[model samples]
Target: MSNRNIQLAVLDMAGTTVADGGLVLRAFDIAATAAGIETEGPERDRARRYVLDTMGQSKIAVFRALLGDEDRAQQGNLAFEAAYDALIDEVGVTPIPGAAQAIDALRTAGVKVTLTTGFSRGTQDRLLNALGWNDIADLTLAPSQAGRGRPYPDMVLTALLRLRIDAVDQVAVLGDTTSDIGSGLAAGARIVAGTLTGAHDKDQLRAAGATHVLPSVGEFAELILASRI
Candidate 1:
């Protein structure tokens, strides 16, 4: 039996379990251009850097920070979703190698998994449908489904409540971004692991409060199972 007593697992979507192949930047370029940011200038360059820096945050929140106008942010978010969906049709998306097996392992061990994303619910559903993952998770949450997105702890806490998990400490969180680490830490999860299959690096994940750094989500089931010994 696992001694960690983790009854719930909260995982990030894009860049963590889902490999989107840098489509985020491509979509962002399209959205930013539509939002009046020039294609090749310093302004667009700075915005792109910001996008990379805040990879796991809510898309609308990121756009709000970048554009600074609620209206423009809304427009940019819509444009981003449209472009990303189009790209998904063009290129498709895939799961990180072994991520499905890892998730299945965790669930078979009695851990209820909830997939969370910073994207809007519309985009999240589209991604899930594309990957045929609509039924994979015990629950899936977007910022709209919860109160807020990562770096805020709302989604994790919401999962705790929705899943009827008894305590926050019985939860395990995993992601590839600092924002994911921050959300897990803020929610007081017992195991806040950062995987290398996504945005941030080891140092950044540790700095953001990851309890453990993993090579990939493929190792997550082992980490949880090994806690028994």
Candidate 2:
């Protein structure tokens, strides 16, 4: 069995630490349609599934998976970005309930905090700046920075290296998607599932190999404290 005393906490953005109300999916739908993918019925459902399955993956990987061809993939990615930027202009995103507080608490407890996401560096920076989180993050990494994406453990390993941590077993990863859990599991870290972000329900998270599924990050804070005590 692995130790319960975690020294590092790696978090996934989007559905895990932030609440954006399916903004990414909406953007992909619009972009896919613009790319001549025909977003209707089975195709639409397929696209949605593809997006969900590729949540923690790099944007390039997502595009490649969905569009297949390099040219079409590039076009689809550009369209997605344009669509996402437009959506952001109309609707701003916020940190999920207790998300900031959870990070703060973890830091106070001497736990290193790192954020891992599949967003492009430019796009991720814009979102964080808009949320007024320009300085709160201890360590932030995007797909561009990691050089690899989720379900592969590259992002998590990068975060671990940045924190100068040596034991993968001493890390805990929190996310709301299956890819997030899979990445954590792949990295040999304890996985905590956050259901309040609406990425998936508790059952889905558990099925993805999460050690525990808490309602929100706030509840997760309480649990972490209790475990320490």
Candidate 3:
């Protein structure tokens, strides 16, 4: 049976847990430029829309959609990954204010905290290594291991199974993208929340099935705590 209290929190990486300074988008732009996708033409416009629209999805998948071929998509992803790596190396990544506190609070409350992301494990490892957060969460998963990425239940469900969390309804799925909410809802999690910090707006998140939309992940623990009280 499902518990009224949230027992698991499966969080997204980029905009939800860590503040990437919108570098992901900038990296995509670099990939676009590198892939010859364009920057000032009609094709460029379409590519831009696609990148923005596909936020929270696998980077390779997004490139696949934009480039329209597997090989080209891989090329684009490689360029994007390189750009993101360079950006992070130049400017370090920091947790959203109180993000680490929130994670700590959740774990203190006996709720398993796991991170799931659209980045391949290699990129994910690079970022986590930079942040020195490799062992911070209970578990970290990438789509490459989960079989599918965001807006899909695979990663969330995989996390649950790995954590031995039995009741899906006791899970809280929170992120900064609609795809996160979609995955949560599809996985039958009890609490699905969104943050306004990322690629999505309030209306877009609500339309995508978020139970609550907050300003940032910093308030996440407070939100859950308030619910328990």
Ranking by TM-score: 1, 3, 2
Lowest lDDT 10-mer window, candidate 1? 220-229
Q: lDDT tens digits, residues 58-144, model 3?
A: 888888877788888999999999999898888888887778888888888888999988888888998899888887899999998
Candidate 1, residues 1-229: lDDT per residue as tens digits? 3345888999999988999689999999999999989999899989999998888889999999999999999999999999999999999999999989999998898889999999999999999999999888999999988888878999999999999998988898999999999899999999999999888899998888789999988788788767643
For candidate 2, write residues 11-125 as lDDT tens digits: 8778778886989988888888877887588877898888876676778788898778999888888888888777877898889878899989998997888887877787787
Regions of model 3 farther than 4 Å from truth:
none
lDDT of 1: 0.91
Candidate 3 achieves a global lDDT of: 0.86
Q: Candidate 1, which segments miss by more than 4 Å at Cα?
A: 1-4
Off by over 4 Å in 2: 1-4, 192-194
lDDT of each: 0.91, 0.79, 0.86
Candidate 2 RMSD to the correct structure:
2.1
